[model samples]
Target: MSEKPLESFVGVVGKETWWSRIEALEAAAAEGRRCGWAARQRHAIELTIARLLRAPARAPNAAESEIVHLAGLLAASFRGLAAKGKAALHASLHAALSGDGALTPIFHQMRVAERHRRRGFSVSFAGLETGAAFDLAISRNGARAEIVCDVLSAEDGREVSRQAWRQLADRVDPDLHAWLAAHPGRYLLKMTLPQGLRADGGGENASPAHLQARIRTLLAGDARAQQDETAVLRLDPLVLAGTDTSQHGLLAQLRGDFGPEAHLSVTVAGQGVFVMAARAAREDDVGTALRRRLAALSGARLSGAAPGVLAMFLEDTDLAEWRGLRETLRLEGAARGFLAGAEARPVAAVSCATRAELIGLPVPQSAAGGEVRFANPAHPAARSPELAAAIRSAE
Candidate 1:
């Protein structure tokens, strides 16, 4: 056994071999319940990490990629860390490879790209850094209309989007207010609020009627909040789509306002997903936010799930931020502290710009029938196992 190569052992493993190895190790540890058993498991995990670090620094093919991901998964199971611990481990691996070359920090780059994914006028408020901007686009039968408003203040808070807009009023620059007032009939003020805000009791408080009522009351009771002319600013429910039934309200209002002729599109940035909808004929830009969000989530989910094998997927990755990873990991003779007898972990990850690249990474099947066992359910690739299999079979 000691004379044979590591790849020789791993490469010959059958479908159940990886999981069986993990289960046997775990059962042994549980049966003995001894400190020595736990210690041995830890040592094995450390040894595995060392082997991975010392492995030749070349772009791995599909088989080698499977080995890395499997190795990481097996090591992680041996350590018996919880989900949060696994998350930290996943994060640390990426961090180690971050400064090596042109590699982008996986999470950081996803966030930046996610911020810019929307297709509309991006509005930044004065004084505040341009974080993520809310995108709202309205199209009539005739033309497309867009407006960029700097978010001055959402209820006087620095982070306008995070606060509950119950009794709050956003103080924008006078110019923004003046511009909206000028187009009272066409452009109306719609104060955006964070989603998932629960009431004291927690059910239906975040509903559309409740939110609309709150917005109305806030604007009415505050003498200074009202504009000189318009009574209530138009409510763009597309902006509120994912925030419970509030989106339905927006849809109803949109139908009433636009009738059968005009089209309205709204996209609100949510965590990892974008809430987007279109009425009437759709345009090419409609799916921009959703596509970007999917790509970002897929990259994040894949990296967190399997950091060891993540390096295998970086060959086609853009080198702008990922070059450092290759440089660091490929360094010759550097004392890999954790890789030398000490317990080691995986490194950071790279990103892909498209769904095909993300879903095309090698996946371990649970059965000979080709059922994918180790992908995020939300991943677009996981949605159609047949298609994924066909694609892989072709490759």
Candidate 2:
């Protein structure tokens, strides 16, 4: 290994051994001079490497934690493909760089694979090479287990998606700034999306455009509140009796104030401030989405020849919602329920990891001990000590 940390890291990324593929990944990002999530991730990794090249070796600081985790993740993920799984690598890198949230599934697969490997299993991307529906193959002793990795979004069970809320927020930013300027006072806009908010709205009232129009009407008119079948919008004094200025501190406060399930954003102009918060009439059922996804992928991805592991990654979740699911046993209930269903016959184990595990947070910050996994006791291989490390439940 090179004494230079950057050189060492780059080497681990196979910058020398896998330069052609690296160029291919870069080429995919370079099409028409395009830049997206993958491009940004690439840039971030390169920037971190550059920083590593200049900085002296010392104890890892909080700032370097992201770099360390990112490097480890990429290094482990990329090396698994090597020169043999070009198609899989191409597909993954393309999706991730296209900024389409492909990183969730790809990283989920790698993260799970890493966990199994650390538990003493020899892991392979057989599915990637063979074009199988599943994503990974892990072997321990004389037994092997096939894993089908899938990702489920938390928005699936909601009447109003977070993505839609984000689009609405962006669309309303200019209008909100103007409204703040005209009003010149702090305000809070609380909305209840009963019929639900959608980005396209499918040519209906649920669309962000429709919502924007409603907000515009509220801001321009004398009415302090508006309600209809689709939504309820209320404008009130922005009374955020709170204090915090450090990074993510205000956000922490805001999330604490609004709770995890609400879609929240704040816009400030000159001396005026505006806070927009919205939620569905009911709570989101992320578990229902997970169970549905399990049913959808069960037969299609599992071969049923060997004990199968369905590794699920739940995305678009916040710290609060994530914790609530576990504390409330919502996640375990969902997974165990699926394990009892007919579709779970081929599955010897079901493991779930959330966004925190995706980002590689350490213990205490991550799920205590490790990922929350459940073993199917009915499966013949579930009790094998050799396979226990891979198929057994941690919960």
Candidate 3:
């Protein structure tokens, strides 16, 4: 018999091994329970072991195997803690793994799922400075999307009294209203109030639909508030067109609206627009407000952008603002690259001009520079002879 290296198990039966490991731990727990350990001790051991065995192997390394062994020891320790009725240790472990204070458990779950397949529904939201927990999730099949919103209190006070909630709602409403107004022919606006958070009787009465309705109503009101704030200013469209394209149009537009001192750039690769204003301008506040507005307009299709940054996909239906902005930037010299789809190869290239800072360091002028060129970099675009000719012409 030969000892098998953990790396050998990397691609072969990875997920199955995790499941088997968890099952073995559970069986051990069952045996311990039958041998006179308390039920709580057995349960604690089961949970700790299950969580630890959840992650798939990232590489075939002895160190990783050692970590798994340590996790097993940790699970056994939990059994002893439970038997001693050490509330503090139990709480600490729970906090370290899952509860409010612990994120390790969630990370472990995500790592395990990644080995099986790409996540389909995972999303992450930024936390409010006001102490609200951000939400991140991986659905049963692993798809992911993240939403960042202000925290609302369900306990005691009036719903409207939550300042953070009101501010969040207000920031989001304008873009929602703009989007609704701009596409009235294709889109419908609907609003509904949710059932009260507190159930009149007992048991959880909040259905998914009810929660969704509440979100809609909050957004509707917020849009109205945004309209009130910007009532005096009219939005004007910005256009960009030319052969020597760049991101100057975007910068120009931002300079015009937010002031010339504002530094604006779009990251084509990441699908994000970043804005930074000069001293004394409250850039963070401006960025937050703008992000909320863009998010509302995009129907939350946009994922989380960094603070003072806004992000949206080029395929969004309500992309007129973004299109107009991107075009202006194109005329101003922003390096742009187009990919066929989310996983497709690049189809077009724009000279890196938008924000030189945001683009990757320029490709070396010669292959001798020790640079590795992308395999099949020309595939998606080369299929179009005219486009391939254009790329060559630019070079």
Report the C-alpha lDDT of model 1 over 155-195, residue by residue, as the tens digit. 11111111222212221222223433543322224433322
What TM-score, over all chains together, does every model reach? 0.19, 0.79, 0.21
Candidate 2 C-alpha lDDT tens digits along 1-395:
12343454455544543344444455555542212333434344444445555575655555455455544565555655657575566566555534443344665676677788899999888776777778888887889889998877777877787667766777788898887887897788899888777666853438877888889988888474398878899988876556653325655677778877777777778878788888888888888888888887888998888889888877767666787888888988988999899998998988877756655567555687557888998999888898998887884
Best by TM-score: 2
Candidates 2 and 3, the one with greater TM-score:
2
List RMSD in Å for every model shown: 24.2, 5.5, 23.1
lDDT of 1 at 215: 44
Candidate 3's error at 11, in angstroms? 25
Which candidate leads in lDDT? 2
Q: Please give the lDDT score for candidate 1.
A: 0.28
Candidate 2, 129: how far from true, in Å? 2.3
Q: Indicate whether candidate 1 or candidate 2 has the larger TM-score.
A: 2
